[model samples]
Target chain A: MIVIDSPPLENCLGFLALSSYVMTLAPSISRIVFPKYKKAFLPKILLKNRRLIGVFAFLFAFFHGWLLINKRHIDFSDFRTSWIYCQGIATMIIFTVLAATSNDWSVKALKKNWKQLHRLTYLAMFLLTWHVWDKMSGHWTYVTPISMVAILSTTALYFLRLWYEHRAEN
Target chain B: MKSQRSKKRAISLGALMNFIVAIAVFGVGRVVWQGVGLRLSATGLESSHNLPLSAEAVPSIPASHTLDNQGTWIYTVALSPEGSILVSGGYDGQIKWWDRKTGSLLRTIQGHADAIESLAISANGQILVTGSWDNRIKVWDLKTGNLRRTLRHGDDVKAIALSANGKLVASGGTNNKLQIWSLETGQLLHRLPADTWIQSVAFHPGSQTVAYGSQSGQIQVWQLSQSEKPRLLQTLVGHQGMVGAVAFSPDGQTLASGSADKTIKLWNVDQGQLLKGLAGHIAPIRSVAFSPDGQTLATGSQDTNVNLWNVQTGYILGRLNEHRQAVWTVAFSPDGQELASGSSDATIKLAAVHDLAREAIANSPLAHTVPSERESDSQDL
Candidate 1:
């Protein structure tokens, strides 16, 4: 009867998380690796919407968490009982905090700590990787390609930013 | 003024690019998740927490006689009425019969050109009916493993059901036609056109009535009395997705239909009214069967779980998650002690339902507080 269930929504949440991760990474790449290329249209666009993208990612993560809690009927008491459940709940918590503090007011209030707090996105990314891998283990045919792309792109961007920063310092 | 306008334009362009990048990334991730989910459902890997007891933990439902090495998805399984032989047919297009006790292959009968989707064993266990994707229905002598006769259809045969007396075989398929045939003579007795592809069929126990569930989510019951042509009795409508499997309670009072909607609906057969909807599985339900005594109902789902429900109360008694892939069919042995489940993973699992249910009761805290009548009744059975 065309019932809207959890699986499709879960996929959507995964997509939103991925998009958020990429969006958050985009501005850093533009600022560090391609500082001279600031005029580039893609970099400028990503820099402008970085906060919005992060907020969206967090929203998606929240919805994902809500859906899972409702569908699985998970008891919060068992949060420490299962490793998979713990990892997922921890990731959601991180996303919730990041989303709550994504505004300019939090940036002004937390000052330098804001930057460090937002760095938890990297941790969230790592946990999400492990979560997806653990859940979709045998179905590598479907998961591997997208994961490789995300991982390789992030890694390549990180290295490029490091190289550019080193060159500027020298 | 020109420089200020240029700067503003650049900012807008950058915002647009961010939006585009976000959309692209989201799209890729969504596609990947969807693909994985579909593949998991197709292979029956979708996981559910409903089954706390893994296959190994439950010693009662031992991996008795894995008829493996066939190397293809087993779509349908049936145990002989006598419970001496187990027969499974699948994408391999070969029906393999095994000695139920020894777990040894007794015979492999081949005739269908394509995958066999549905199978039914007559009450006497003398005749075996199989509907195949090859658009053919073949009746075989269960004892000899010989094809008695082949009935051709206009499209792939999706489901088949044998009458209690084994005299009539009802089949429905992708052709949107339901045909009743004499198993002995292979003569097509009646052909009824349906609104959509028929995915599952069930014959009412000890009656001339037959039920067929369709892709359009409608369940039709027909009374095929010999005196009159087959008459449409009632249409049970509730399921939102394709009805994958339907089974009649042993007593013939209730009919259970499992659907891709991930719910099992029990209907009062005589009144043709929906009784209760049993919802637990996270994915599509592929098969459903009532225990021999009609007290418990077993449902196999694309979520890779075989869930046992108390038919009277619609409460989940326990879940069997032995299969790694979607469980396509579940059949209780004639005596109702053993529950047989076939999966897309190409393995047939024989579960001791009685023992598993007992263990569930012992493990559950509600054992003392809540008196589950169905659990006790199953134990008595």
Candidate 2:
């Protein structure tokens, strides 16, 4: 039987979550910063499937949590003691909340507060990124270029959008 | 109305396509990431080239010597028969001799132009043979720390084995060729072309046969006779990855091979058939050695642990989890009292096997969970 450590698989799942989360932000980018490109096929497709992608991201995050728990053999004692464990547990809680509210019924019930509650995705993404960076503190070479590109490009896009809005106001 | 229905169906199809595209991206991205990481790590280009950067951070394992300052990955380690001197060879292209008791660096012998990948000590403890990525095998007089002679190969030498009599030395490497040479004269006796890269070589205790394990997962046993060329005796095949180490039990009755597949397989030497496979290591098995009494087998793995297994029962006796990186090689002192493990973390750990095993039995709950011999054997088959 083939045996492998759970880290690589966990890292891959994390990357998938990050990638889908980044894609979910594409609609906002197109609408605010690149309205001329809003009608583009890629942007429109990503915009239409934003909710589905968000749900998939949370699903991948949950699986990543399961694998991490199995690998670390973490229990309530570990969750209470270690800061690294606390970071992971907190990240999983955020993802669970986001996934639970990702449906249309929750969107209608929460109404205006739905968008406010879904903003927790940003916090989840930040925690997930921090968790990955902490785990790979010394060994950054194993951190995939795709995750780096996705996270950085999303940040840059948001910053550019803010700069455009500020200049317009001025 | 018909156009509206078609548009809704198209949107559903688009969502399905988007999900498929996302999965494809994730799958392809993961594969590429893993591929690049493996290649970089294999070539020693990973960001953290050494694990546990300082000697102070090393775990408190009960080793007689925790020799540090090698400054690079140690690929192989050997203990002299007298158990007084320990030698380690590594990517630094230097073979270091240490006082086994004091853990002090006795001397540094350097001549190889590249990384030393393998080392073998003669049964008589007179000669030390080292094979290097420089495509050369150099024999040294252990007493005087003098280089006797150097034998050149077509490619980097990956493994070396010295006969019990200390007369014949078998060397194999990336060239896919196995060469048997006289240790005294450095004359090549026989050159056997192999099907794949030979990662490890070992001579039977009786010195009548030599076995080498290859990257293609085949272990070939060659019988050495007086006049004729070495005859291929048996080709044992079972491992799924490169067989990195091959060792014979002290009695020469059983041969154990450790592989990149993460399993150690025991073969009945006479029949050339797999008897049992030990499967505790979570990563590639880089080295394997049997204790002097031949009752315990030690395997060093990329998981950074050295596991000792009961030879007769295939039960895990204990695990030495001191190394912070891949444990490249393991060796038992001539008396079988001390076990030495070399790791990519650039430290050599020399622990008293008996004391370590006793402590593990008394403390570790996992030690009591070893599977039965019958169960392990059936599972292996």
Candidate 3:
């Protein structure tokens, strides 16, 4: 009825991007959240491959966007309608910068600034939450609610940890 | 000691933030991958189109024929009154006609410049009207496959319905404008405005009434007379999501509305009361139709299933899972013996609904299938 007709390939690529992006950040998060399991095999392997995983995530996201634009014949001239997708566009921009700078020379040249720039991943992730929610609220598939819950819970945990740490320090 | 504790807190907070981001990404990733993977095998061709035609059957409900390799999702399908000819249209802007009995492609019309969104055929089977994304509604002579007229719309024409009398064609689209036109002269007789885009339209069997479902989850029924303006009969609003399809029962006393909210509701036409709600689809419903006898309702959905429902009790009589992708449209043959479903997998599947009905009747004593009708009424369109 409401045909949002994206091919399976497009969806798969999007999923891959999400998965890799999560994996890229999962190790450190797990280390802090569950300190006892910080040395776990999965976390160690993920950490070792974190840079490659981040690059792969960016690649998948790039293809996903490209495919949608090409297949849908999206008209960029209609800024009024296109403005609704600003969050997704902004996230992609951050991913592009991260992907471009995922090299030794750029990291050395920028030094401490590189760390600051890479922190943009958090902002990108926050923006993506809004993007997915905005686009898929009414048109939810099985994965939509689960993704929302996991994202929300993890975000909540961050604030909880922040509050607890702040109270202990005081 | 305080500085050390602050640094440790920063480290943990950064890690926790990363974890939160990761969790969100992972959740979305799995949804796109595993969720869609269950419905579609996305590795190679991403569709079962490559499966040998011999293996197309699904246990009880057998696919009669598959119009193969359609290139993209077939958005809409219509069956002739007598049910011998099958017409389908989709993203490629081509209208394909198939012989119902032989399962052969009869003719392909390069109809529009954009994807065809909706299709309707006159009860007499003489006229075929197509609504397209190119902002045009084109009428074709069903017999000769020749274009008769092209009626322009303000925007993408999403829905169209032809009156049973073959004189009036009602169309609505993204412009939030529902326009009624003279089928013969291509003159716009009336234009009505809605709060949002109209996704589906249906004309009452009596030809004096018209109903349309909108993106805002509202269904409006109107009374139309040639001498006077169309009067609003009722505004039915219960669906939580967009109403994708609406069809009037054969008797015109009941209206069946299907919505993206994944539920099919039966409404009392005159009273505008919700009669019954049928919910079996796990995904959004795209199309709905009532059998000629008004005993059965067929609904197609993004869940890749076409469910046949018993209209009286609001129970699922049967389900056809022959489609590997989202079914965009479903239509019952005038005789009510066959069902043709068009899907995003680029295939049109013809199923034996009569047999499905019989099987359901065997399971539920209260259920009934359609009886045979006059043969002359099925003359090839």
Candidate 4:
């Protein structure tokens, strides 16, 4: 009954959009659900398991790209130069950081800097959501409800994590 | 008294010479063969007998190839029966494939809840099996890249291998057992028992026998055709560290085992005798593979190099030092024309076995890096 004019074709795009939203919340969920045992708890050689979660997230992002960059079977050539593509380009960049640091060597090589670089994943999550919204124009109606909920939920987790870290530092 | 001292000095000199010879031979081996003569590797080994590039090898053009992206830490690799596919498993619990030619990412088959420690592709190229830390073996359909089934296990699965016909698959891990499955019916046909925690498994050619190595430094052979009860056919004991990998020669007369003690041993299967001990790698050796023809051996190591050895002489033919990080997995193309390796560096590489014949690699995996810029825009954090 809440179908306030959202197109049927847009729902499929919503599929990719939904996948992204689900992925964007992974870190926040992992923190709240299994706080004591985030990826750092796995064996050293197996630490890539944690980073692998990021790989799948990025892959879902790519599938999102394929759908947007590809309309029908026309290919990347046929798509309009939408802001969504730029946002996609942005999301891929953040994912690349998460993916690159997936290795122990990358962790060790980058040292303290690696953790900071990975923190960029926070910026990327919202940018990617915005990118998805940009596809829907002013009314990506189907996605907007969930997006608003997720953005607020993730923002709450973010601030809570920040305050906790700051209090611990004190 | 003078004579005794002179004899002692002579004996010491002989010992020194023997040590030097062993080190020299271990470092590299030059085997002169019929065709596809080797182009010498920079590490000073002559691999004249590797598959001619025209046969199973193809020159790499990196820009055209989108190398596999599986886990951030790769542990194992295997070539599909057709050699057109390369499967790599990583510490990230993901198994990914790439086109053998262009190295483009063909598919990412996901299911394992933990790191995938090993992989095996069925000989007919129909199924790709993986053993994971999640305590299971997953059988995947090659063409569709879908997770077909998950064979539950009791502990971490360290190694996996498939038979030549694509009918049987084997997995070895935590409980010191080799679990064999029938791909056709999705039945786990048998579980090969072990004397200790088994580390690796390899199927002998043309038979139901499987050769496995263990943390106890013992390599046991289990014949599946006759009985479910594994026989203590041979205990290939020599290495001081754990036996990491084992392979049966194409002819089935010999078996090769590599260990963490930094030595590779060839055992006479029928005789159960240690034929020769190959030592050269500076660190633990991870996996060993025999080329299709059985004349050459490919080995990956913690030393970050893949060494090709002459099976007959136990001599190092040449060293492939391209992975930059530890080269945990290696496989030969079905036709024996190419060689592929997966490294901890998060990339899979294909080298034309024949390209070595040209005397110098025009370009290697070391020279190229993935598009690092791909990360800049995508982060949601």
Chain B TM-score for the candidates in order: 0.82, 0.81, 0.82, 0.74
Residue-level error in angstroms, candidate 1, position A13: 36
- Taken over the whole model, the C-alpha lDDT of each candidate is 0.74, 0.75, 0.76, 0.63
Can you tell me the CAPRI class of model 1? incorrect
Error of 2 at B199 (Å): 0.3
Ranking of all candidate structures by their lDDT, best first: 3, 2, 1, 4
- How many clashing pairs does model 2 include? 0
lDDT of 2 at A14: 80
Reference-based TM-score of each model: 0.59, 0.58, 0.62, 0.54
The second chain of candidate 4 has a TM-score of 0.74
Instruction: Show the colliding residue pairs in model 3.
Output: A1-B286, B82-B378
| Runs off by more than 4 Å, candidate 1 | A1-170, B1-35, B38-62, B356-381
lDDT of 4 by residue, A1-170 (tens): 12222433334454554455445455554564447766554432233234544555654554545443222111111122223156666766576556545555566779999989977877875775576555443323554666656766666676777777778689
Model 3's CAPRI class is incorrect
- What TM-score did chain B of candidate 2 earn? 0.81
- Tens digits of per-residue lDDT, candidate 4, B103-217, equal 7777775657666878887766778788876667888888788778877666668888788777788888756678888777778778867877677889888887788888778
Q: What is the TM-score of chain A alone in each candidate?
A: 0.78, 0.82, 0.85, 0.63
Predicted complexes: DockQ each: 0.02, 0.02, 0.03, 0.01
lDDT of 1 by residue, B241-357 (tens): 989999998888899999988889999988998888887677778899988777788899877788887675555676777677668888888887888888766788887788654
